[model samples]
Target: MTDRRGLLIILSSPSGAGKSTLSKRLLEWDPSLRFSVSATTRAPRPGEVDGKDYHFMAEEQFKHDVIEGQMLEHAHVFGNFYGSPMAPVQAAIEAGRDVLFDIDWQGAQQISNSVLRDFVLSVFVLPPSIAELRRRLESRGQDSAEVIAKRMQKSWDEISHWDGYDYVLVNDDLDQSFEKLRTIVTAERLRRAQQPGLLDHVRNLQKEFEEISA
Candidate 1:
């Protein structure tokens, strides 16, 4: 069989909807999957590794790249710039390696409508309830009360875009949601359009049958 084209799998959600954790789990489940490391102008967090967590860059450089059309999708969030670089994503997909993106709805919308839309599989994760969402955010202990309030407002905005995604999951339980996510990936990989080699395989089968009949 010929190599199948790689999928651009995107996961988007509100701040406390468990999208990040699920993304990590998916990466662990499929080691060959390439995670789309985004470029950002924000300062790195305490434990964030450069290039691994994010490709931290100066604002000037980031704007330069954006102006040069190197970014696949970008957004200005919370006074900082964040975007997916096109070159790395193209290289990975061309090599038949699926690329996973953990981004917000704005980025996802840009990519979903881009020239590479055919290869995109976008999923939106939703929290079970607003109350639960707040609880999860508080549990993290990473944000101050003010920041948390800001995020809560932003979360509502994010959740409003849920209908834009190809797949939607209400993440009431982590394990079940992950299982559903895995199933979606598996099914998408098996899609007829994703498997270009199927045409050749079917043609070969036809030829073999004709030869046997003769």
Candidate 2:
């Protein structure tokens, strides 16, 4: 039987390192996973849907949640309000489905520090190099030089903290990186800490073994 304590998979990478793309791919490929939609004050872009792409709310509403302790982890990034809402994530976890987090190290640390350690597994994705990161960001063609420079600078800060993650995968090749991440997720699901019924399974097997010996 598959392990069933469920999971909180944190996928963090600086912009253009492919964390978001990999996360989306993982969710689409794995039926047992449910993507965690973050709550934010940022307005939705064209072709982005509320509650699906994100739980877009006003800054006032987000601040209310933060004050009321309704957020599992919330942070201010690049002058925007962003947070992982408690209710939906909790509900998903309790239902025995994996919940994916496309959040930064700070938010991940907060969740881990709050004693939700057993359910959380964090992975840091790294680009091949600073040069490759720059090329990839430029290839996206979505940002101005100033914005890209900001992200490249931010990447230096984010990538320096790679040691904090449970697993680190370098994205030199997309297919290989995807496989590595997939394997980690599957392996984590089998960890004894997350498998609630492991003791029961062991006990039942022990009984059978003793009966045979008798």
Candidate 3:
């Protein structure tokens, strides 16, 4: 195995679409997958680790990275700036570890347009139904009724771009969705584009074949 670079898996979904939850489950089940820790200007919630849950940075520093082109993709959500930094992601790929991106459509576009595009595997997770999405949002209890309403309003806009992704997983159930994600990751690792050294490997096998006949 060449240990060639791994997929830049991008999963985007509206709030309550179960993407984050599903991402957690998939990583739990798969040891090789690594989550991309985003940099955020928002204050960390309880129990969140600085480098694990997010790399909390000051707004000035966040803006500085954006200005300097250090971010792969970034978006402002509810008054906070959240972004994926370029260096760490590129370093991970160069080290042959699969990096995951849990970003929205706008960020996904920014990433897909960058050099990382060649290695990207974009997956959009969709709610099974609007009703189910509303139900899930309500259960979280962190959002007010007004905020939940806003989230529900944006889901249609978010999911409308489903066709742009390489794969779509309907997150009706957590375990099933994780399996679907896992399947995509596994299949992409064997894709021809990921294996430029394949021709050489095959040529060596062909010589062995000729030797057998001789």
Cα shift from native, residue 91, model 2 (Å): 1.9
Sort the predicted structures by TM-score, highest score first: 1, 2, 3
Candidate 2 lDDT at 160 equals 85
After superposition, the stretches of candidate 3 with alpha carbons farther than 4 Å from their true spots are 43-48, 77-80, 196-214
After superposing candidate 2 on the true structure, give the runs of residues whose Cα lies further than 4 Å from its correct spot: 1-3, 42-47, 58-61, 78-80, 203-214
Error of 2 at 24 (Å): 1.8
What is the model-wide C-alpha lDDT for candidate 1? Answer: 0.93
**Weakest 10 consecutive residues of candidate 1 by summed lDDT:** 1-10
TM-score of each: 0.89, 0.86, 0.84
- TM-score winner, 1 or 2: 1
* Candidate 3 Cα RMSD (Å): 2.9
lDDT string for model 2 (7-124, tens) is 8899999889999889988988897798888899988899999998889999999999999888879888778988888887677767678899988878878777654676899999
lDDT of each: 0.93, 0.87, 0.87
What TM-score would you give candidate 1 relative to the actual structure? 0.89
* Residue 3, candidate 2: alpha-carbon lDDT: 38
Q: Per-residue alpha-carbon lDDT of model 3 for 1-214, expressed as tens digits?
A: 4447777999999889988887787677777778889999999999999998899999999999999999998889889999999998887777667888888888888898987899999999988899999999999889999999988888888988888888988888888888888888889988887775687889999999999999
Model 1: which residue pairs collide? Answer: none
- Native-referenced Cα lDDT, model 2: 0.87
Give the per-residue Cα lDDT of candidate 1 at 11.
99
